[model samples]
Target: MPFVHIELVAGRTVEQKINLVKEVTEAVVKNTDAPSEKVHVILNEMQPENYAVNGELLSQK
Candidate 1:
């Protein structure tokens, strides 16, 4: 089994996330010889207030 973790700032449509996981699964299957069913993808969506860059919170940007 192959595990993939993806982190992004919250605010994407369900359809977009579905496409993302689908595409990612295909890529992992192609490169790692992992079947779609055996590939696990974890999406970590963070709120703007919980993410930061350059010492500044994303919510404040």
Candidate 2:
């Protein structure tokens, strides 16, 4: 079994997240020999206010 965790800023379409999980799971299954049924991919979405970069809050300049 393989567990993959992904974190990103919130605000994405369901289709986008679905495709991302599918593609990531497929990649792991192919590269790591993980069973497709046992592979897990989790996407964690955080609000802009909760994320920061370069010492600046994402929600604020």
Candidate 3:
């Protein structure tokens, strides 16, 4: 089984998230030899204020 974690700023559309999960699972199944059903995809969406880059908050940037 493969566990894939994806983190991104909040506000992504459902279609975008769905596509991401599909592609990620496919990749794991293809390269890692994991079964499609055994591939786990986790998406963690955080608010801009909760994420920071270069010590600057995403919301501020």
Writing each residue's lDDT as its tens digit, candidate 3 over 1-61 gives 6788898888999999989899888888989887899888999999999999899999898
| Candidate 2 Cα errors over 4 Å, as ranges | none
List residue ranges in candidate 1 displaced over 4 A: none
lDDT string for model 1 (7-44, tens) is 99989999999999999999999998877899999999
Models sorted by TM-score, best on top: 1, 3, 2
| Backbone clashes, each candidate | 0, 0, 0
- For candidate 2, the clash count comes to 0
Rate residue 6 of model 3 by lDDT: 90
Q: What is the C-alpha lDDT of each candidate?
A: 0.95, 0.91, 0.90
Taking all chains together, the TM-score of candidate 1 against the true structure is: 0.94
Q: Please give the distance, in angstroms, between residue 61's alpha carbon in candidate 2 and its true position after superposition.
A: 2.5
* Model 3 steric clash total: 0
Q: lDDT value for candidate 1? A: 0.95
Q: For each candidate, give its TM-score against the true structure.
A: 0.94, 0.93, 0.93
